[model samples]
Target: MTDEPDDLSDQPPLVQALLLARYTLVIHSGMRAVSEGETWKLDFASQIAEIDAALQTAGIDTTKPMFAPVKW
Candidate 1:
């Protein structure tokens, strides 16, 4: 079998949208717990909020913010 890779940039519109949504979610989640300090949490929360709006504007399903409240 050949080891050729598929070009995601040339994917179907629907497929591209799905991939974009997944990427946005992953990035937002990654930034949510960068530092353990409260200050970092606040910054991350703010960043997530902005990203959510931007993603929604770009037709992504960023309906929920990535900041999950601490259970402690």
Candidate 2:
């Protein structure tokens, strides 16, 4: 990927926190429901896919460490 100015690390702290929280909730709930033999909802899976797409489109490096030392 070419060097992109807009990366996940470039986002504000609050935005990062919110995104992480949302991701955690969705993944945790989805896993629990599946493990309990509950019918999995496609909506949750779609949301995750959407999130992944959005992140990728935003030039965010999903493969790298999200929290790195910020040199101020």
Candidate 3:
């Protein structure tokens, strides 16, 4: 119970958007596939899609980070 809560709002808007996008991609493609059943997959995809749409509507860039390749 002592674990501190991690708040995304503490991050910049663009960074928050990018972090959400990264998490959505990973959960949709990786963990959910094995851990979730059929019904949950659709729900998860729908939710992720909504988040992505909202991020785009807010003008957050979705392009792959240029520095990611070099840094990784």
Candidate 4:
């Protein structure tokens, strides 16, 4: 993927948030896999970090939840 900042302004805020969250989850999963007995090189981790940074720069609030907390 190009390193250009993703133009997520056209999407609804919730959709943009969800997409960012998905990318974040993918990076986290890769990190967990590497920590849990995986021997493959993790060269892509830096790229993932860059992407997450770009997403944040694009104004998506990565720290906020997309949905309300369940009361149950």
Question: CA lDDT, every prediction?
Answer: 0.49, 0.54, 0.52, 0.54
Expressed as tens digits, the lDDT of each residue in 24-47 for candidate 2 is 646465353355666654346556
What lDDT would candidate 2 get against the real structure? 0.54
RMSD of 2: 6.7
Worst 10 residues of 3 by lDDT: 63-72
Ranking of all predicted structures according to TM-score, beginning with the best and ending with the worst: 2, 3, 4, 1
Against the hidden true structure, what lDDT does model 1 obtain?
0.49
Question: 1-72, model 4: which lDDT tens digit per residue?
Answer: 333444555567865665655655554554423456756543455555665576677776545433332235
Question: In model 4, where is the ten-residue run with the lowest total lDDT?
Answer: 62-71
| Candidate scoring better on TM-score of 2 and 3 | 2
Error of 1 at 63 (Å): 24
Using TM-score, give the best candidate's number. 2
Clashing pairs in 2: none
Residues 2-72 of candidate 1: C-alpha lDDT, one tens digit per residue:
33533446556764555455545555653545445543322345555665566557665544322332235
Model 3 scores a C-alpha lDDT of 0.52
Report the C-alpha lDDT of model 3 over 1-72, residue by residue, as the tens digit.
223433556557776765566565645553433344453332455666666677667665444332221212
The candidate, 2 or 3, that scores higher on lDDT is 2
